[model samples]
Target: MDFYLAAVLQGLCFSGLALGIYLSMKIFNIPDITTDGSYTLGGTVTGIMLAAHIPQGFILPAVLLSGGVAGGITGFIHTKLRINALLAGILVMTALYSVNLTLMGRSNLPLLAFANLFGNWALTGSQGPDSLIVLLVITAALVFLLGYVLRTDFGIAMRATGNSESMVRALGVNTDRMKITGLAMANALTATSGYLVVQLQGFADINMGIGIVITGLGSVVIGETIIRRFRVVQPVSVLAILLAGAVLFQLALAVTLTLGIDPTLLKLVTALFVLLIVSLPRIFQSRTA
Candidate 1:
């Protein structure tokens, strides 16, 4: 039970990443690989700040800024330099690796001695329940705020920029700025995931972001599958579905681990699971046909 609980907490932590991926891939139709880097950038910033005895509340803006900058760089490269979005993202992600290392001054930094976001919550004399509640609140607030944003005029423009860039451009929407802003916001959320995870795990490592994009992608894929299955068309409900998908994805992995799968094979299992989610509908349709 505790193992599964931990998995649930992890899913909550990654919810931000799932939201980020949803924005970039689903909203903007850009496969921004910057997720792999900006995530660790969040952790790196948090680790350094906490280590310096900074207030946890004061660290969030820094994390968001770092992540946003990383993403913005990718967007700039893609839009201004006329590079492929994927390649531009890859370039920024690769650069962020060194940036994270340089900022941390090492490959790994232990955060066990620092104050975390949950330090103020002393309920039940155990961190689990408190952390759970806090995460739930945080996740809910994020979804609500994001939903509201998506309904605003600027948000509609952002969506339009993604859905029909040429059309939005013709309408004088400055599609280029929209793309940059969208990527920046997406990576800011991704970085926040890193911020939460590093504090939860009590450590930050340069390699922590490696393959992290797959986790977010898997969650989005699962959410997308559910949305399609239920024919859920409401925008806010779609966000809720994606958040639920993050938790469900983690639970699936926990069950796999409980079944005695080798821990080292977790990544492979994740990949296969995502592939299955992505291919299942096509397979069913073919069979029915």
Candidate 2:
């Protein structure tokens, strides 16, 4: 039971990454691979800062900024250099590997002895309750903020840009700016998730981000699959779905652990889950048609 609760809490921390993935893939129609790097960038910055005794408030914003910068660079490459979006994202993600290593001054940074965001709660024997409270607060704030943003005029322009860049450009909307803004925002959220995860896990590893992009996409797909009927409520529905997916992902991990499954096989499970979710709609549509 304790393991189950822990996994759920951890999943909530990762919900931010799932949201970021949804924004890039669903909203912008961009297959952004930058998230794999940005997630580690966030964790690297946050872990380093915490180890250096920086205040928690400062660390959080810095982690977000690091992600935003990495994403913006990728966007710039795609828009200004005429690079294919996938290649541009790959270039940025590759560069971030070195950048993250530089930030950590090593392949991994451990926060086992450092002060974390939930230190007070942990010291008071309230870690579980406090973590749950914090997760809910952050999740609610993100959902509301994203909902508001997606309803704004600029948001409409962004959605239009995604649907048809040429049409949006003809309408005087700067499609390049929209792409950059979307990517930056998406990666900022991704990094924030990384920051939260390291705080909860007590360590940031250089390899921690491996397969994160797929995992994020998996979460998005799983969420969308379950809530496909809500066309008007897509954003909110996707958010709920992502949160639920994260919980389910964690629950699966817990089950694997209980079954004595090899921990390393977890990534394979995630990939299989993603494959299943991705195929479900097509399979169903074909059968029904």
Candidate 3:
């Protein structure tokens, strides 16, 4: 039970990552691989700030700004230079690795000695349940904020840019600016996940973000499956479903671990699981056809 509970907590921590991916892939129609770099950049920023005894308030903004800048660079490359979106993300992600290393001054930064975001809370006297409450609130707030954004006129324009770029461009909208801003916002959220996770895990490792985008993609895929199956249309409800999907994905991994699968095979399991989810609908469609 505790193990599964921890999984739920981890899922919540990754909610921001999942949301970022949703915005980039589903909303902006970009496969922004910059997630792999920006996530670690977030953790790196958090670790540095926390280790220096910096206030949490300042740390959060710094993390968001760093991630946003990284994403914006990718967006600019894609839009202005006419580079492929995927390749632009790759270039920025590659550059962020060296940046993160230089900023951290080391490959790993231990943060267990400091008072973390969750370490100070004693609501339940058990960090796991207490942390769960904090994460739930944070996740809910994020969902609400994003839901509201998606409903605004600006958000409609952003969505239009994704759904019908040519039409929106014809309507005198700056589609390039929209893409840049959208990617920036998405990566800022992704960085927030890094901030949350670094504190939760008590350390920040340079390689922590490696393949992290896949986890986000898997969560999005699961949520998308649920959305399609139920035909969910409400923006707020859709965001909530994605959050739940993140939790479910973590639970699935927990079950796998409990079954005694070698820890070394975890990534492989994740890949296979995501593949299965992605392929299922097509399989059913084929059979019906």
Candidates, ranked, TM-score: 3, 1, 2
Better of 2 and 3 by TM-score: 3
TM-scores of all candidate predictions against the true structure:
0.98, 0.94, 0.99
Off by over 4 Å in 1: none
What C-alpha lDDT, on a 0 to 100 scale, does residue 14 get in candidate 3?
A: 96
Ranking 2 against 3 by lDDT, winner: 3
lDDT for each residue of candidate 2 in 1-289, tens digit (9 for 90 to 100): 7789898888888888998988888889988899999999999998989989998879988988989998898889998899998999999999999988988889988899998977756533678878877787888788778877887898888888888989899988889999999999999999989998999899999998999987788777767767766553656655777788877777776887789878888889778877887888899999999
- The global C-alpha lDDT for each of the candidates, from Candidate 1 onward, is 0.94, 0.85, 0.95
Error of 1 at 283 (Å): 1.3
Off by over 4 Å in 3: none
lDDT of 3 by residue, 254-288 (tens): 99999999999999999998989889899999999
Comparing candidate 1 with candidate 3, which one achieves the higher TM-score? 3
Candidate 2 local distance difference test against the native: 0.85
How does model 1 score by TM-score? 0.98
* Consecutive 10-residue window with the lowest summed lDDT within model 3: 119-128
RMSD of 3: 0.7
